[model samples]
Target: MKKIIFIFLLALSFGCSESDSASNDSTGQGGSLAVFALKDNYLYSVDHMKLNVFSLINGEKPVKVNDIPIGFDIETLFAYGDNLFIGSRNGMFIYSISNPENPTKLSSVQHFTACDPVIANSTHSFVTLNSNTTCGNNTNVLQVYDTKDLKNPKLIHSRNLMQPKGIGFYTAKYLLVCDDVLKIFNIENPSEPILVHAIDKNCFDVIIRDNTLFAIGDKGVYRYKMNPNDIKDIQLESETNF
Candidate 1:
């Protein structure tokens, strides 16, 4: 159980890949739920080599629609506007979901074998690679890319991290990274992100809604009240053990 917690912590803190249509922005609202992503009336799931598509038209029950074969060791899933990002140990894959039932591959950026999860808004995407027992011989760093062109994502810059896990966008201006510690950065300038504040706490993943921040780690579920005026003024509202 301890081993599972450690692994979960590592995977949760980095970032998760996502996909969604522009019409439905609420599907990928939280960063912590990485395994599954929703777009319109469909839900996509990844398990090793297969991308499973399910229709939520019935809402209560998921109807299996299609099973698309993908690369090995798929780690996370994220839904951006009209696009789905798949994070495999080998690289990042982007898919167009104009037809949610049948997603087509647009492009992919290959990287060294590592544990990676990605998150993005409309313009930029963030991917973090972490070195772990499962991820062999990989350097830990945060890679940022310009997603202006869906077919061709350009790598703009990268920032080295100790061990990055789940990442959250507080706004277009601020980003939260969970690793050995919780670090928030001022990304007003996406190309040059500056670390504004950090907490000496081990964190796995985080999600921000309105003015509240939710995070989970070995300690348990954590909740905080966020102050946009001062990123450093985050107040711990409550905590519960798992």
Candidate 2:
């Protein structure tokens, strides 16, 4: 029942996504939509279905280096090793970021209607098929690819799940999936991911703080007991932010 409600809420909010810069117009998630890499300050995320690259530190204006067209329902942005990757409704899109001012679109691969926003790693990208796709109804599968060669990626593995929901990767080995329960899988072997653990309630996006894991749930953002070793030990610590 809780899972159903989340799906409905997320689906209902899709139509609100729009294009046009925030300064030029007034639309989108009210300029709150954002994604950024704590490691790289050169790239920043924008709500209007594109990414902004800083030409210079503290520049007067950020440039829309990548033109993905906001109306396409893009939700996530990740930049790693001179490349940028985005998660859209259709699939995952890869771009070359040799020049911060101009990001080149390398490819757009189709999958399911992905959402709630995540990128596994700059080298390994993952997306949750939140809902069904035209190809077939979603059975909750996480697509894991060998992006070592960005230009021509190889489909390394697919972890089929039930309502993959949102995802977060700690060391490119463990994939924490959000759903009615928190599902953790050890992808030490991407081709054959092994189940690590599962717990009840909501788990959306997850992050790391010191040795703890921060998870985003329907209620709010909270801390979790994340063991680099054991998944069964994971337990909620305290609520932080949503």
Candidate 3:
């Protein structure tokens, strides 16, 4: 378990490889229950089904904070500057995690039938929907929303993606979509989203900073510096994804 956690933390904090996640759990389903940003001191984890938070004062047992009852599973979470973006079948729950212990759920948005994960910026948020039931054809989608107003987040764009599982945002310019195909979008204009390129190989998780893209796939850690002219072909950086 320690080894796994260390690896995860490394993949997250550093530019190890393509940053993504996969389920090795018994149920073949593992959601990101907790996350702590490099800039923050406290740790935030989720109890998926309950949508409840587990806050750690230092690195101790997680203290129960908030409860979000979303029937399915709250698969992923992102701890941004001041807010906590939660993803589940219930909807996207935006909570203020500034007060670690007393997390207040500021708002909720039920846009898709199944919103399992989220990636965001100060002005925008990106969510992924993977459902076999209400989600037609089990097709994955990328839904962008305006989060300038936390109280009421408005939908900006919804585009279909293939095997979309996880996501992350970086540089405030690109939206990294993690799935069978790792995608990077030129979100220069939220309303007019352009898919500049994608690497359809092994990226399951993505973390980016400026032109540098880090992915965690079956290959382990993959790093690349994306070409502005051609995103599909990126300059490979030092990685252990072999």
Q: Considering every candidate listed, which one attains the maximal lDDT?
A: 1
Model 3 bad stretches (over 4 Å): 1-6, 14-39, 50-72, 111-115, 132-137, 227-233, 239-242
lDDT of model number 1: 0.78
- Give the candidate number with the greatest TM-score: 1
lDDT by candidate, in order shown: 0.78, 0.56, 0.62
Residue-level lDDT tens digits of model 1 in 1-242? 45655454345333322312123354643463376776667878889888889998998887999988888989888777788888888888898888999999999999988888898778888888889788887679888888888789999889999989888888568888997899988887888889989976787778666677777786687889988788888899997666
Clashes of 1: 18
Give the per-residue lDDT digits (tens) of candidate 2, residues 1-242: 45544443344223232221112211122111125421133544545466555433455764444444534666666545566667766677777766655667776677655553445444566666665353245446667777766777667777666666666555556777776577877877776677778767676555443346655566666667666565677777887443
The positional error of residue 239 in candidate 2, measured at the CA in angstroms, is 2.0
- Per model, state how many residue pairs clash: 18, 1, 17
Give the 10-residue window scoring lowest on summed lDDT in candidate 1: 13-22
Candidate 1's C-alpha runs over 4 A off are 1-24
User: Residue 148 of model 1: what lDDT?
Assistant: 82
- TM-score of every model versus the real structure: 0.88, 0.71, 0.73
Ranking the candidates on TM-score from highest down gives: 1, 3, 2
